[model samples]
Target: MTELDPVIHTPARLRIMTALNEALEDGDEIAFPALQKLLDMTAGNLTSHLAKLEDAGYIVVAKTFAGRKPVTRVAMTPAGRGAFRAYRTALLDILGGSR
Candidate 1:
């Protein structure tokens, strides 16, 4: 017996992973506000989820200036991309390909 990697299976985390993975494949990064809108989550909720993903090395958050305003962007890490794929596959398996 070997211990398995900690699984991030929470619904919110799952949603975040899915969204980040989608954007990465499209060669685009999602803005914080857009993610919040898409997830229909509050600022606190989004921040908490983002922190969790960032701590787990699943995503990277970049803070930069967009002209005069500060902007935040989130992108999936390589490990995150792999894990998100596995997560989707696990989900599909559980639902038997119908959901």
Candidate 2:
């Protein structure tokens, strides 16, 4: 049996990773506000989950200015993509065993 990634196994984190994996193309990023809206998570809740993913080296959060306004962007790192793939495989394996 394969071990699941505890960091991504949490429901919120799982949703975050899945969203990133599905939404992003290579080298593309999503605006923080857009991601929050898509996930339907409160700003604080999204930030908290983002911190966990960042700590795990699974995502990058960049804050910069768009003209005079502050803008935040999020992107999955290569390591994150690989981790997500592994997590998906582990989940599939677990489900496969039940049949």
| Winning model by lDDT | 2
lDDT of each: 0.78, 0.96
**Best candidate, TM-score:** 2
TM agreement with the true structure for every prediction: 0.79, 0.95
Minimum summed lDDT over a 10-residue window in model 1 is located at 1-10
* Per-residue lDDT over 16-38 for candidate 2, one digit per residue giving the tens place of the 0 to 100 score: 99999999987999999999999
Please report the TM-score between candidate 2 and the true structure: 0.95
Model 1 CA lDDT for position 1: 28
